[model samples]
Structure formats: C-alpha cells, structure tokens
Target: MPRTPRSRSLRWADVAAWRLRRHHLRGPLTAPEPWQAVKDVSAALCGLHAQVMSSAEQAVAARTRLPDAGAAVREALWERRALVKTWAMRGTLHLLPAHELHLYVAALRDDRRQMGDRLLAQQGLTPGDVAVVLEALPTALGEDRLTREALAERLTAVTHDRTIGEKVRSGWGVLLKPAARRGLLCFGPNDGRNVTFCAPRYRLGADDERAERSTPTDPAQALGAVLRRYLHAYGPASPDDFARWWGTGTPEVRAALSALGDAVTATDIEGHRSWALRDDVADMAPAPTGDGPLVRLLPAFDPYIVGPSRQLVSLLPHPALRSKVSRTAGWISPVLILDGMIGGVWKAQRRVRHTEVEIEAFVPLSSGVRRRIAEEAEGLLAPGDGHGITVRFA
Candidate 1:
C-alpha cells in the first residue's frame, strides 16, 4: 500500500501573508489607469495570488476605496504584456502580469492542446478547417468587441464550416490561448457579465526584439516555469491542492514537485501531507488585524474566504460547509470574514437608487461582532452609492 501523506499544522498568520502580500497585491496599487490596469489591479486586490475569492468581492473592493484604491489597481493592470486568465489555476480566472503570462498560459495550453486533439477527433473537424477557423479570429474580433453571435457568424463565413458553433468555441480557444501565451491579449473589464478582450501593453524589459523573439513558446517549457512559480508563491500546499488548482494529472503534479526538490519542503497538514517554500515558514507572519477586532465584512469570494483550505477556518468543518462557489454561475455571494475565516455568506442588490444587502450567518454572531458587521456593511450602503444594507438569518 502507498504510504499516507503527513499532516502538518500551519501558522494562520503565514497563511494570511501568503494570501495578502505575495499572491495578490503584486505591486503597490496606483491610479488614472486604462482598462487593463483596472482589471489587473482588481485582480491583485481580489486574487492574483489565489482564485478562492469570487469575482463579486473583487468588484466591491475595487470600488470600495474610491479613487485612490481604484487608481492604484488600474496602474498595475496596464503594466503587463498580457494578463493570464481562463487557463489552469483552479481552471477559473486570473490576471497574470505580461512577463509572466507566457509561462502561465503555456502550461495551460499544453493541457488544453491535448484535449483539443481529442475533441477535434470527436467532432470530425479537419485540420484545414480548424486552421481556417483559427486564422479568421483576429480579424473577426479586429480591435472591437466580438460578441458570441458575431464570432459565430464570422467563423462560418471564413471556413464555410457547418459546425459553426463548435468551431467558434474551439477556434476561439486556440486563438486566445496562444495570444495569452504570446503576451498580446488579456482580460478587459467585465462587459456586465464575463471578461472581454483588450490588447496588452508589454514591458519588454531590456531585452531587444530579437531576444524577445528568441524566447520559446513550447508548452512544456511553460509548464515547468509555472510549476516553479506556483511553488514559489503558494508553497506548503499539498500536491492534491496543486493538482486541483492546476487541473493536471497526479503524475504531473508529483513530477513538478519532485523537480522543485530542495526549493520546497514537505510537511503534514493534520494527517495529510502538504508542501511549502523551504524558507517561507520562518519569513512570514499573519497580518495584524488590530487587538480585540474580529469582525470584517469581506466581499464575495474574498481572499480570506477562498484562498486557504477549510482547515484554516477554525470555526467550521470543511465537508460540512455549504456555500457553493461555482465558476459557471458568474455570481458570488459575499461572506462575513470573522476572525479571518468565513463565518457565513451575504449578497447585495439594488432597489432603484438604494442598495440592500442580505446577510446569513452559519452560526449565531456575538452582539459585538454583529455590530461590526453592520458597520462594514455600511461601506456598501453609502449615499449615492446605489445601495443600502439589510441583514437576515438563514
């Protein structure tokens, strides 16, 4: 029988530092930025470090601090070649910096490319037909937005293809994934729903055009680079977590972990084995949330909610927790971050000019914490902010 992995207790403070500093907040937040800057900075505040947070919390935080906070985030967003999204890393979304996009997307593309061949075979799409569909995308999208229907129409015209729908989906994946790999296109602001496309402003560093051109686009190389970066950023995690986040086979996760070698250290979480940066244990601490303070109204998908494992949430058990966070739904209900862990979930919606938020607690709140939660909710209920606050029990 295979030996079971060991469980190591982790310092909650270290977990907080990993979630706040290294992963999100890549650079100091800035202002007067482009859409790209806004997207990237929002990502930093929300989760460039981890996808545990929902996109809704991201929007709240982006708008919460007004000009100063929003501007800083936008400034950081535009400083990259492309921001990586829709590839690996929980198979959700992320806004990677330009210099790093290539490595991140390349790994994901390799995984997808393998699936593409299988999908293509199942769909009976000829290579020539697929190529034709792919070629038409850049022009179809042009420098303008390409809605779903518009892209479908353009693909049909270019390839004279019968399966316009499937082709559009697959071919767009081919184009966007490579663009993500090549440092060209990145996530734009949400067009009310999902992300739209925009060009990236690349920082080529000191490398000349030739040197930049010489950089490899091979997917395996990208995967290797990504493995290194993941361990570097979120070390002391288990191969299971990495596999879940990256959507790779166990063999692949193990191989990558093995390659990391001394750069990482293995420890047990409770009884389960996990990994961490070799020196990270000694170098980090949990953020000081001030003495006797416990209540915080974390936006939906707040980093504190989704970034760490359930074990980190001392008040609740993992399998017993009920709030579902699904990627396809595109809706993230806000939650109460009590003592730096999820206490329950909430949501805010507009009634004409007024905004109302509904709060549901998994456990009864203390009178003091409840008051603080109301205060935090008030941030979302400011006058002229298009909302008001209300709490209800589940």
Candidate 2:
C-alpha cells in the first residue's frame, strides 16, 4: 500500500543543523568546487539554489569563512539558468539553482510566454516579427555584451525600421532567456545598480548544437530524488506538503511518492500523516556539538524556509509570522536563525547609530538564550548598533 506523509517525532536540532549546513556550510558557490557541495547535499536539500552573500563588514563581524559567499551563490543561480526571481514558491524571490529551475520553468514557460506575449502585443510586436527578432539575436549580440542600446541597434537593423525601440525591448526577454539556456550568456558582475548580462566563459560551439537542449523532465527517478531528499531534511511530511512545494497536482505527487516507496516509511502525527527517510530515522547521525562558530541571518526568501511544503505551520505556527515574512513588499526580511528552527523574527533598518533590529518571538526567551540571540544579532548587524529587540509571547 502507498503510504502518505504523516507526522512523526522530529528532532528540532537535527532539522536546524541540516538547514544551516545546506545553506552556509555547503561552501561558497563561486568556488569551482561549488558543484561538489551541491552534489554532496543533493540528497538532503532541494530547490534552494539562490546564494546569499553578506556585506564584507557583516562577514567580518560574524567571523565567517565565506564572507563573499553571496556572489558565489548568485553565479550558481545563473549557471543553472535558474531564473533569479522571487516567484518560485509562494511569491518569494529565490535564487533557484539550475536543475530545479529547468524543471519549473519548462512547466511554466507557456504560462510565462502568454504573459510575455500579451505584454509584447501591447508594445506593438507581432508573432512573426517576434520570431524574426529572436532569430537575429545571436548575430545581433555577436562578441559583445549587447547592452539595451546595442540590442536595439541590432533589432532596428534587422527590421529596417527607423523606430524599433519598443520592438527591441519587446523581444529582449525572449532572446535573453534562450541565450542563457544555450550557455551563450549570463548575468555579469553587479555594478551596485542593475545586473547586466554577459557571455559565459565558453560559447556554444557546433559540437554542442546537435545535443538535445535542456528540458525539465520530471522522470520518476527525478521525482523520487526530490521526495527522498525532502524526507531526509524535513521528514515525516505529508503528500500535501510535497504537492505544495513541487507545485504539482496530487496525482503527480502520488506517483512521485510511490516511486520512493522502498526508501521511505510513513508515520502518524496527531492524526496527520508524514514520511521519513527509513535510513535516517533508523540511524540518523548525531549533530556535531561544541558551539560551532557559524551564525547566519537568512533573508526571508532563503531556501531553508521556502523549499519545504506549505504546511510550514508544523514548525512556525503564528499568523503574525506570515505577515512579517510578507511585509518586505519585494525584499525578504532577514531571519535570525540561532540554531535553526527560527529562533525569532528580526527586522532591520538603517539607523543613525547603526542598523536597528526589531526582534519578535513566539516564546519568552530566557536570559541566556536571549543573550545568545543578541550576540548573534550583533554579529548580523553593525556593532552595538542593533537594538530595539522586543520579545513578545505567543
């Protein structure tokens, strides 16, 4: 019989450790060896491809090894053609890594295309012209960064139009995406303003032309890989959670769950269902102790929170918490994760003295725990500059 995801006794420490290591300790993404970390945690973490970089001062105060980690993570985001947007899960922008990017985008491309097409039509671009422009991009961008103006020139040249401003901008997104997929280009270094697209180290040569382009194939194997990894990190979860995370329907989720029958087991949780990795539950490794030096203030859209299913209430149950996560408008608030499992919610503002962190908690923090949280927050913000940390009980 196919088992559904049910609740089980979860070790908060283990969960915290897993989340931390996956994000922080997996090593810097820019290191040629970033993929090593990806492959290492491949079985335990999924869909969290965005890299989180911290300011140089923040890294020094926090005493982290990968102070420039965020840049690496961003590169990882582009390398995989993972759309660097906030809409992957529940409208939170995440730097989704490559593989998951391909899958989700494949399923979503048409929906996006419709939206893109509608916008283009409004800008006076016809389907035939759109096709022609896309075909001209390679030659248009040949051996150059192809800034907006440069791209416009190329489009005007092809269309023989005195004014092709809207036409160029309209086809910009369409051409750039395919260019990225073909490994011909990607986002270059950020100049403190907008991120400009540039060519990758290696151009797409003729030898690569015949190979099948990347496709988001949700094979039973791939789905099984995703399910097993989730169970390993956030185990004893129900299919509903899986469905929500994958953004797929129940039948697809069921099939994916079925594919992992041998590697997982179901358990009961307060009349609910979840699944756990059979191996981890039986022989889960003990979390290394002795107060590790690492501490992180993960941004709101950080994968640790976003990758799991919608039933996050299992871990974070307050409705206010939900509101705080969304308050940023477009930016994700920084989360204070002392030892994982959301020690508290923190908001930061640029104050005259320094950055001010307004912290709210669901439980009353003891002096010792509060001290640790404060110390961690200090490391996160400017020195002695973070204050106004309030503690409220749920």
Candidate 3:
C-alpha cells in the first residue's frame, strides 16, 4: 500500500500527525508539574484504560516530561483525588480525571445493556434482586470503603438474599458492574491484595459521601459532548468505531454523531467516509515527507492502540496482521509504531537495576528506526534509578 495522499481526501499521513499532536505523542509535553502533565494526556484520550496500572502510568510518562511518573500517578489517584479509577468504557478498568468522571458516567448510565439481564438470569437472579442491591448501595457503601467480600456481606444482609451474596462473591464484577455503571459503585483504595468498592462520592472525597450524589447529566447532551471529544482525539472515524470503543450499540452512537449536525464535518480517509470536529478540519494538513516519530512504543491497552475509532483503518490498515495486535481474551499487545502504523510488537521487563526490551518487527527496521526504538525504550525508565535498557530483537 502506498502511504501517499489520495487526491481530494484528507491525507492519512496528515491525520496521523494531527492525532499524534492531539495525543501528545509527537514528543514530550513541557508542563510546570507532574499532575498537569498526567491530566493533559488522560484528558486527551478521554481517559486511560488502566487494566494494567503500569501501562497507564507509562502512557503518560512516554508522552510527558515528568520527573517521577509513578509517584505523580499515585498522587492524583490516591493523595490529591484528582483521578478516579473505576470500571469504565466497555466495562474495563480506567483512570479518569476526577472532574471529567461524571461526563463518561452520565453517558454510560443511560446506555443500558441486555447483557446484564441475560447474565442475571443465568445466575438465577432477577431485576428486582439487582434493584435491591442498587438501592442498598447508597447505604452499603458508606464513608469507609468496603472490600468485595465486605460489600457482598452488606448487600446479602440488607437484601436478605443468600443467593445474591454467593453470586457477588463468586463472580468477577458480573453482578457488580451494573451498579458501577449506574454510578452507584466504584473502586476504593487497595486493601493489601483485596480490591475494595465504594460510592463515587466517597472515593472522590466529597463531604457527606453518601448524600453528595452528583446532579444527573442529560444523556443526550452528555453523549453529544463525549462524541465531540472522541472525534477530536480519534476522528476521520465512523459511529461504529466510536460504538466499539464506547461499548455501546452502533445505532445510539450513530444517532449521537448525527445530532452533532454542523458541529461535525464529514470527510474521506482512504476512500472511507469519516467525520471530524468541523472547527478542526482546517488543521488537517498533508503529512511532510520522512518518518514522523519513527519508532514510538505504546504499552499494552494504551488508549491509542485500543481506541475504537483510532489509528484508523478498522484497527490498523493491515487487516491480515490484526490478530497480532488485537489478540485473544481482549489483550492488546505492546506495539512498536512506525510512522503511525503498527510496525511491530514489543515487550519489556524490569530486571533489578536494568530494563530489558525485545522487539519483533513485521518488516525489517532500518538502522535509524532501530536507534529510535532504543531511545524510546530508554524514555520508559524512572528518573534517578540508574536508567539502563537492553534492547534485543527477536
């Protein structure tokens, strides 16, 4: 495939560079402090899919110039209450900016799933049983956070249903995610190895945690707002892409994007119809020659890699090799990106004082590309920890 501009269409290369700029992936962001840098990256991508905490931290570190990336993530999440970690989009764990959590939740709470009912029935449970759990959540989750087992006990005691307790105890968020998406439940700080749950108000540290429910966000308006943000970050995309990323039905996403009307502009990318924020159409210039950010690495499940509407071309242009990136059991491999396309896959591990990285490229890498990959790997290190990296190709 010739990576060139098709006549009368937005240059895919230009779109790639523009998205890199939007994601702060073009280079390190210079911010006054750490949290600001972290928030900037998180906000740009809507939020970080924090299925793996280190991957989420590296997602920010690689894009921003932070002295101590890990500490900064902890401060926002644990100390400053600036970030909220919860089950978000597609029912996966995410680290969202505290201020923006409601926007995502507002859209999510309104989008009901038939899967929940089906799962409930499979467990011999009913909507009323789940409703009782939802209603009791306000009280069950108090000022202090409760572990899953602890919360299960409370729900079982309150609902007086031993079956529900067993289901909650045995399952991995199957019964609980409904309350989570409904804004009735969220993750609390760790209890050693045990994961805890609490009300969103409590984790956010609002006074009267139980009483401080946020004002309801209009689903239509909220969906509209989120769609605009998505288009800006991952535009030249379709509603189906957004639906896949957002874990919602295509019809709802299509309706929301249509509702945007003049706020969005339709365009073509490689002959496929896509839409972008109308105000941003002018900024979509053609890509300059030479590889842009030749060898950037994205950790597993990084938003740019897992994004529904992003790195476009229906999960990369190489449909033949899509299985390597989008693996089984919903695992997105840590990828090596060459000029905004999935060039290869890579993995890294910390070995005491040094970090070891192995790269397996789909096509041969030039000397220049190899050097850039080494530098990109070095950037993943923590400051003042004797930053040393060993790069190997497999």
Candidate 4:
C-alpha cells in the first residue's frame, strides 16, 4: 500500500472543527439504548478515561440522551458485562468494551512491559516474582471475585511470598496491572466499598469464549486496529500525539502509522506536521466555515481535552487560564470550551437536593453563552428537576 499524498496546510480552526465532527458533537444527537450508547461512544472515542468513575459516567451522559445515564453505565459494567474496566493505554484505568479487550491489551503490550519493569524495580521485585503472581492469579480468582486484600492473601498462600502479598495489599496496582494487560485479570463486582478482581474469562463468561473463538489474536493486527480507531476519533494529529496518548515510544507509533499505509494522509496542522484519515483530509478542505462559537461544558479528563495536541497553551492564550484548565498535580479539571478553545474552568458539587455548578470564565461571557452554560448544567443534572440545578458564575 502506498502512502496518501499530503493535503494542503490545515489551520487551527480546521483541526478544531474536525475534532467536533469526529467527537459526534456537531450533528443531531442519536440516543440509543443505554448499553448501546455506552458501547457506541466508548468505541468511538477509543475508550473512556475511567480514573474517576463519576466523571466517566458524566462524560457519557453529556453525549447521550439517557436520563440517569450514569446508572446505566454502572449497569453495563456490573450487570451486562458489556464494558470492562481495565488498565489500558497509559497504564490507567479505562472503560473498554469487553469485546474489544484483546485488541487494546495487545496494543499496550510495549508500554505495559515498560511500566511493569519500572514498577517491579520500585517494588524491589524481579520478573520471576511477577510471574509467580501471574501464575497464581487465575486459580486464586477462579469464577469468584476477590477484593484486592483477599486476592493478595490468596497470592501469598499460592506464591508463598509474603512480599508479594504485601505489595498487592498496598494497592499500588503495580503487579496487578501486568496480569490485567496479559488478559489474566480485570475488574469484578465491588465487594461493598472495596473493588474486586477476577479473570477476564470469568468476567466475560460466554462472551469471552465467543470472542476468543472469533477475534484474531495477532498483536500486529491489533496495533493496526488501535491506530485506526485513534485516528478516527482524534486525528489530524502527529505521531508524537499518538505516542503521548498511548504512552509508547515515537518510533513504535511511527511504525504503526506506516503500516496503516494510504489509510492515513499526512498534512500540516498549524505549521506542525500531522496526519489524518484520507477521507477526512479530502472533506476538510476549506474547513467547516462558521463564526458562531460552540460552547461545551466538558467534564474532567474528557477525551476532547485529553486528545493529543501540540499547541494547547496557545489555544487558551492567557497564562492563568491555561494553568487552571491544563494539568495541575496531574488533575485535568472540568473545562468550559468555547469554539474549540479552553475558555474557563468549572466545578460541580452535588448537594442533597440540587447540584451546584460554578463557572470561572477567563473572559466575560455573553448573556447568551451564560444561558447556554446554564442549560448544559441543567442537562447534566437531568431526570432530576431542572430547577434543582444551580449555575453560579464566579
């Protein structure tokens, strides 16, 4: 396969519009059944950042029309087994569809190895120690869910290594993540306040068996699938962006992009080299012309804000506003996005009866925009009384 010819230069506006369109924010919202909606959006965005469970649910609710969408998301995880929370790209917890687990696990193989090495060194353990835990995990977990503490006890008994049990009980998830990446473990139902773990095979049950029978287990093919999905949802991006997003080396990302061949087209975004889907580049010429600003109240760690970028600081311009919205102690706060730029920071507090949403805008927002922000907050608190939602400008 030959590489697609480079398209004309793309501006910031083009990239922003492409993001909105690709994120399913431009057109009429299609409200599918709750589980289907979660699956659709999760797959579309590659995976949902689930470090904060409430935030992940809210992110899905913002895209779908389901009332009490958050509850539905939980149902999908605890009941339907449609979505599985596991350590994926960047070695962070994410909600990936159960059917696609194999692909993502395989795609993160290199990064997982690197992370495992660092973690093992930090724990003063060897690869042999990790293998012992891995070997014991499946039978220890069996068809039952075990809390981290309980699982650690089992590991201690099985491996007969007190240090392994101590590390597991420490809750760092260092040794456990390797097992997850290798498809030996995943999140199970919560045991009261504590989270539990079980084998992916046990969690998926018949679904896992079906997937194993049908899904290709080739790592190279899985890498290609992940790259294609990433580009589809967050393209017109550079290999550096992909590398950053995946937490993999740039050389590996470039190799995957190369294997994609003409499926990806090279272009210059804001004077920086980038790549996008061939069809997307063909349609993005002249960009999506519009002057009306689009306002979106995106939750913390939303995919739109988390996607790869070269000049995010320039998008906000103001130093203080940039700091507020961007990383601060590894936390990406909820943001108010106006026309593809980080316009302000927002925080929400759910009271007993109502949800209080406070917005801190970098620049004075127009009355209409403020109303739109209020409307968004109301929608976020929906299936509950709209009047119960309060939006305060700080």
lDDT of 4 by residue, 1-394 (tens): 2354555588777677777777766552454568777877887888899999988888887777568778888888888888899988877889998888888877665454456566678777777777788799887788778899889888888887788898788747878887888888888878899988888876676766677676556666677778888888887778888878877778777887888887888887777877887877766643343644687788898888877644566567485566676675667789887767778889988787788899999878888889988988887665665448889999
What is the C-alpha lDDT profile of model 2 across 1-394, one tens digit per residue?
3654543454545555554554443233232454333322322345443333342123222323333334434443445432232234332223333334444443433323233566557756656655565576566666665556666777678667645545556554543553443334455545555445555433323322222144434455555665676666665567777666655566766777777766777755445566667765554333555554233555545546655535444445465575555454434455555555555566666656555566666555666666666665654453342343333223
Q: What tens digits encode model 1's per-residue C-alpha lDDT throughout 1-394?
A: 1132443466554554554454333123334444444454534432353243234334434343342333434444434433334333544555455445545555665564334556556656555554564466555555654555555676566666658556656554543444444344456555666556644432334432344354456765655556555555555566666665566676777776676566666665445466776666555555665644455565555433444333333334353554343234543456665544456777767577556667777667777777777776665344434455665455
Estimate the TM-score for candidate 1. 0.68
Identify the candidate with maximal TM-score: 4
Worst-scoring 10-residue span by lDDT in model 3: 1-10
Worst 10 residues of 4 by lDDT: 283-292
Q: What is the lDDT of residue 19 in candidate 1?
A: 46
Quantify all predictions' global Cα lDDT against the true fold: 0.52, 0.49, 0.76, 0.78
Q: lDDT order of candidates, best first?
A: 4, 3, 1, 2
> Where's the lowest-lDDT run of ten residues in candidate 2?
55-64
The residue-by-residue lDDT of candidate 3 on 1-394, one tens digit each, is 0121332377677677677777787778766768867876788888998989988988888788576788888877887777788888888889887777777778888777634677777777677776777787777777768998998888788778787777789877777777877777888789999988877765665532322255337887788788888888888677877888888888888888877877777778767677788788788874454663456888888888777534434436466777788789988888887767678888888787788899988877878778889888887753566868999999
Question: CA shift at 211, candidate 4, in angstroms?
Answer: 4.1
Candidate no. 4 TM-score: 0.91
